[model samples]
Target: MSHALGIAWDMWSVGKVAAVLLVTFILSQLLLSWLHAVRAKRIDRKVAQLCEQSPKHECQSNPPESLPVTLITGFLGSGKTCLVNRILAGDHGQRILVIENELGAISIDHELIDEQAQKNAPSGVIVLKNGCMCCTGESPGSELERVLDKLLDFSQGDSASLVFDRIVIETTGMADPSPIIQVLLRSEMNGARFRLDGVVTVVDAKNLMRHISPQGPAGFLRHRPEAEKQIAMADLLLINKVDLVDSAAMVALTCALGQLNAAAKQLRASHAAVPWKYVFEPELDAVGLAQRRQAALSSDGAAHGPRVSCVTLTAADDVPLDALQAWLQRLVQERHEDLYRIKGSLAIAGEARKFVVHGIHADIQGTLGGEWGGEPRSSVLVLIGHKLPAERLEKEFARLSGSGRSND
Candidate 1:
């Protein structure tokens, strides 16, 4: 009887220990759950506060005192560089920072333009070494984010601590302007500092018709031609070299452009000669920047058809905190044929440095970037490809960034 009593006591002790362990585990899980909830709320509060402080009183709009950025894009030999130089040479009296992206193996536009300016150029001009800023990174540290970081540093280092009054970006002839525009519009850091003033497209009047129609004698029908896309996105269309085309041809071309983009202001000029003020301060739609952001996010590249589309994803927290690498690897392996270009920045978890991600076709990269200064660690990702699974990709990014659905 005594032996049976001892065994019962031993069983009771074991049950007591098991109960203690189970209670501890439950309590620990609850604690973790509470912490994650708190962190999420904090992030939401920060975003809300920022929105409240914004001049547009919306989370997605630019600050009232943000710098203005002018984007110049066009076809090859369409006088994009020439237009940029003209703006630089003009007596705008505002300090300007120019970002130049080249397409060839060697960059010569910056030097050529500087030489042509003959001391009338802007305060500083930075030439990007990548072949094309729209889609040039094989790893992280996207060309766009790197350029923005540099701009921030430069603006801070200036003696007056005064950022340039104006910033101009000249894209290569063969680039898609949509990604560049998205970067300026969606990037939290960029929107806080620089507002998109206008998009000026320099059209080679001689070749404009040839590009607009694939059946023209030149027959330039690529899968995704940049010329038509450039025209489609232009706020101001400069039909350059009008002398090459007769008045009747000019009228016809203008009509054709109107059909493609009725909203854009069409102008004719010889040698890209247009008043700088027109390019810099065109009458933009009166909607606040937040409304503009909504329009941009909803309608970006919508008319490009199903064969090619651009998917942009945004996140409020840092990525790679979870399985970012595994997810990206799966993306590249599964979608190499459809993936064309990828670029953006990430706010790393528990780190001061920002992570930049870039991919061109199958080549993908992610690299550490500079620290975020007084700005929330919001992340942005832009993808240009054919038939992308945007929903799945967005979900994965949201999971990585710790935002439940989407950032913005």
Candidate 2:
């Protein structure tokens, strides 16, 4: 009888231990749940406070009348997209949106822009993908108006009560930005809530001359006049790819650029990467328009005009980087006056990737851009200058290919 009583006592002890453990677990869970609720509440309160603190009619207010717009413009492959990516990646704390114009049918810039936007969370970005925003036509303009309408709706609607703080429009490489500006500056749209911030132009130091010319034997003389127009209209000019130009050429280029647009502020950059502070912190004023107008009026009497030209050559296959470099060096030495810029994508053998090559006068800059996903492509070299000899340029490139030291 005593042994039976001991067993009963043991069972009772086990039951008590199990009950305590269960109670502890339940209490811990309840505590965790309460903590989570508190944290969520705090987050909500913080977001609300931020919303309240943000300037009304700037980002959060409905029916905003004066929204800032930044227009980014550049030539093809000039790294405008890169700068835009950097700006969007920054911590502006305000809601932002982007409008991009793709050069080709592929819309590569759109993908890059979206990728950057996704990386910079919390800010909203929208892409208008029909065609170049600067194109003149019913379809393009209508599309732009529709996009603006949508943005307006967002600003007014409850869903977009926290609307974007800034809007950025990236024009196609070949687009003329004047029309786009006109649309935004329309007096009729004064109530549309969009304001013009400024036009930022990205200039490819290596290809600046080429972009301006694109037609001579060396590919720099063609369409030379239009290139000047682009520079003349810029509010802010970013001279990118500066690393590709030597001191002498860089100085000359800077001098030429200054002559081209004396009123616009010029900034130097490598890989088209610019500081966000300089780009976003500027207080765009009405004086810019006045300055531009004055510059235009005085341009007819200006003596110094753009002297560079451009030439383009397409290669059937990848050429060795070393060979191309040597050729470029020789060209710059022999034809520096006629050779302003050279830029293109090259396919190098055994590298399994594409290499980007850019040159300013005698200076050459190159880097590997990862493996090539598309089909085998030829090299496109755009040479910019005056009086470039097309035959000589071709012969030099061909000779470089023969040396078999092409890969670098």
Candidate 3:
């Protein structure tokens, strides 16, 4: 009877040990899961805070009554997007808003923030697309008036008050920015709601010569002369792509650019990157609208000279990727003399994606943007330059489409 009791006791002990082990395993899993949840929440909060403090967010607040508008301009393939991104990553004590004109329908800048979110960045990003404001017949003055009206409506809304410290307008790569500037200087909407801050023009160090010389691919928009006009109008000139060019070349380019526009401040940077503090400096002097009016009155060359010719080519069908690349390479190499800026969207055969291409002279860059959302549309290529023979350019494209290989 005693031996039987001992065996029963031993069995009971074994059962208790197994139960304890099972409970411990479950508790460990629960603890680990809780830790992960806490970490994720912490990260999300951080990103949200960063987003709120970004320059894009700060623009929502009204700028100084005297100076309120900022124009960010850059040539094709210059690091304008990079600079914008860097500015958005910092905290600049005010609400900011960005109006961007991307090369494609979809803004790649929005995608950058989305990508950061996936990697656990702590910020909320939003993209607003209403088509290129420049292309739209919407008068710049009217647009500003409409935007201010909307903002006021939002500010008075019950949900929450809306405010902005500054506003930034980023023009498209091919857009001539003179009209937009004119709107700011001459628009009746000019008042306490908005002020014209300054114009920042981004230049590519490697492509500056190509942009200015009639021999390069961009030589076609009459680009050399047009680019000079842009340089002349800028308040701050950013010389980007410094890494691709040597120091001597960069210095020479800087001096040349300075000579073109002595009134503007020139800054050299690689990737068009700069400190956020430099861009959103709070130092703004008050200037009345009447002063702006006087300046406009005094300026004689504010209007764009004559309408330049633009040649546009639409693809018959989706072209093969290799074929298109080869064709473009050859065209850029051979006809660099007549190309000002090549801007367009392309559909590559056999690929389930759309490609966006931008070129200045011989320098060309492309990427598979988003997937094909709608039916294949004809590719639109606009070549802007002086004395561009539409027939010859079209003929060359036709020959390339027929030939399997490019002249490369």
Q: Pick the candidate with the highest TM-score.
A: 1
| Cα displacement (Å) at residue 244, model 1 | 0.8
Mind giving the per-residue lDDT tens digits that candidate 2 earns over 1-408?
A: 999999999999999999999999999999999987875565444333323333356545355446778877877788877876665555556455666555332223454344443453333333222211221111233334434443443454322543456777776777766555555544334445565667788888887765553534766345545456556556578889999888776666665565555445678999767766566554322233224334433443213334533334555656776677676667767875444444556667557766765444445566666566775555555554555666666666656545321110
TM-scores of all models? 0.47, 0.45, 0.42
Instruction: Decide which is better by TM-score, 2 or 3.
Output: 2
Candidate 3 residue-wise lDDT at 396: 60
Per-residue lDDT tens digits for candidate 3, residues 286-382, read: 1211122233334332222222334445554667778678978887777765554455566667677767665545656666666766754445555
Tell me the tens digit of each residue's lDDT in model 1 across 1-408.
Answer: 999999999999999999999999999999999987875565444333333333453555433677788888898899988876666555666666666665332234553343433343224433222211111112123345434444444444332243357777777788877655655544343335556677888899998665556454445454336776777667788889999988777666765655444435667889888877778876533122123234444442313334445555776656664477787888889996676556556677777977766555566667677778776667766665667777887787777767734312
Prediction 1 TM-score vs. true = 0.47
RMSD of each: 20.3, 24.6, 22.7
Off by more than 4 A, model 3: 1-67, 103-161, 187-190, 216-224, 281-408
Candidate 1: segments with Cα more than 4 A from true spot: 1-64, 103-146, 155-163, 187-191, 216-224, 285-408
Q: What is the lDDT of residue 325 in candidate 3?
A: 84
Show where candidate 2 strays beyond 4 Å. Answer: 1-65, 103-162, 213-221, 224-226, 283-408
